[model samples]
Target: MDIQTLAARVDEIWAGEEAADARELVKQALDLLNSGAIRVAERVGGEWTVNEWVKKAVLLHFRYSDNREMTAGPIEWFDKVALKTNWREAKVRSVPTAIARYGSFIEEGAVLMPCYINIGARVGAGTMIDTWSTVGSCAQVGKNCHISGGVGIGGVLEPLQASPVIIEDDVFFGARGEAAEGVIIEEGAVLAMGCYVAGSTKIYSVPEGRELPPGRIPARSVCVPGALASRDGSHQTYAIIIKKYRDERTDARTALTSILREGI
Candidate 1:
């Protein structure tokens, strides 16, 4: 079925309507997701558009499927979703302990180093998911981005209306950085290590001496963890400071070598 028809079917299933081929329909949606034919969210006309129906399909899958045992070498597990096993065909290089669940699309030329990618996520080509990092369910990461070690890119399934985290192309997310609650790290942004961003996290633009919109890191920004005094002048709270835009020096520091992206 085309995306339009699939979307309608997913909506119907989500509404508790019984379709004789409900499970099949859900499987088709997942298959599309796995092949990168569809995404839970994508940029259209320079704005991020969330596909609520796709998210609904993912939720419906959990309800319709049953958990079972799965084993990989000495690793035995029981789960509702299956792990992806097509690294060679996908042209993705995955180091030991790297795992990506079924229904996630990992484009060719990407490298996974002891990382975890959950269902409904889409990782673009030439990206690197570093050791101990996690690309959460439904999070959309674009091309040539670096998800550094121990970073957490948040995902959302419940509240079907909630948006998943979006990390655009050329982003350099430093080690231990966390982006959650539908926060958008725009293209070419460089986040320093340990930076945390959420829907309500304050983002102060140092150059402008003003606060930018919450939940968004502007393009080409160089951000770091910071603190600001509360409105009441009573206490300090965590914040993200946009120190400057990325420059040649910044690019050199965060450069992702082509050699590292090559070969299994």
Candidate 2:
């Protein structure tokens, strides 16, 4: 069935009454998710849009699911969602203890190093989710990105209408950092360790020499933690763009590594 057809079925089943093929529809939706045929959200015309129906289908899946016990080499799990087993076909390198829930997609050349990927999340090709990092529910990560250790890419499921976190291609997230609450990290940006980006966090631009607006970090930005000093001598946490790349052909990794150390 087409996405629209599945969407319509989900809406019909969600409205108080259950359809005779509700389980089958939910199964089809999850099957698509497992095969990487559909995503929870995508960028269109430079703007990110939530595929609400897909999220609805994910929510509906939970309603139809029940807890069951699963054993893996002495590790026992009792959960409604089963772990994905198609990594070999997808060419994803998942280390031991790396956990990815059902209804999520991990594309080719992606490495999961003891990380956690929640439901409805889409991790793109050539990306690396390092140890202890989390790709939260419905979060969308783009291709060739490096999500460093202990990072958190937030989910969007509670309100059901909220947008998921969008991490664009070629981005690098340092250890222990968080990009949450509908924040958008554009392509080629590098976030230093301990940096936190949320909807309300202030971002300062170094090349432009001003404070950028919240929610979106511009493309090719090299961001590091900074202190927004108050006039009365107090300070608050913030991210500063220490540098911005003009071309992808440039040696970004070396430049970013040097730039991130400038503030420290």
Candidate 3:
């Protein structure tokens, strides 16, 4: 069936008080999966791409709106079918209410840490996802990474063409950092504490004497706090820079000052 039709059927099944045939629904959902008509749910910058059927199913299962409620049979049917069919990696902890759809990969030795991970989110091996960190739809993440507390990796599934957040290997995100608007954080880059990087934000290289305008950051560059000349020409709003840490300044006082300078 077409996406619209499938969506309508899903709505009908979810909205009604009666239960659906578990075997039949699973069979149809599997058919859509095999045909590539349905996909995992993911969002980027306020947009998401999802199978209409899955969307309706999720809404129905969650009792999402006041307009609808799911019958016990369908809910149980979905639980059994999803358990049997969904591909998920072995993890230490996961929310019983959370769902993993599509063919997204989550490798072993990685900890999910009880948060929602949408479809099309490729999580690398040995990655630790802390509390309240969202890996938005289609956000690709690399291996052995630490997504610290409250980090948001954006997804782009809507508009049918926008890119998602691509994070390369061995990166660290400080608390509450927002990387959205198809931003690409290259391998080995470290985002400092409380950095909110959006698509339109300017990224400057103080050490290289260059500027990156929107949706990009240079690879392997250490991003630390810096300053920009204010609009009123009075003071400067501190900014962040991806700079190289020189080893020549090994002296304790100089190192402390250098560290302190970046924070201010």
- Best of the candidates, lDDT: 1
- Lowest lDDT sum, 10 consecutive residues, model 1, at 153-162
Best by TM-score: 1
Cα-based TM-score, every candidate? 0.98, 0.89, 0.57
The better-scoring model by TM-score among 1 and 3 is: 1
Prediction 3 global C-alpha lDDT: 0.57
Instruction: Indicate the residue-level lDDT of 215 in model 2.
Output: 91
Q: Whole-model lDDT for model 1 versus the true structure?
A: 0.93
Give a tens-digit lDDT track for model 2, residues 73-175: 8989898898898777778888899999989999887888899999999998778898999999999999878899999998888766488999999888889
Clashing pairs in 3: 42-137, 43-137, 44-155, 226-239
- lDDT tens digits, residues 110-194, model 1? 9999999999999999999999999999999999999999999987975443899999999999999999999999999999999
Give the candidate order by descending lDDT. Answer: 1, 2, 3
For model 1, the superposed segments whose C-alpha errors exceed 4 Å read 158-161
Instruction: Give the Å error, residue 84, model 2.
Output: 0.3
lDDT by residue (137-229, candidate 3, tens digit) is: 657677766777788887664533356677776677767887887777776677776766777666678777866665665565667656667
TM-score of 2: 0.89
lDDT of each: 0.93, 0.83, 0.57
Error of 2 at 36 (Å): 1.0
Q: Please give the lDDT score for candidate 2.
A: 0.83
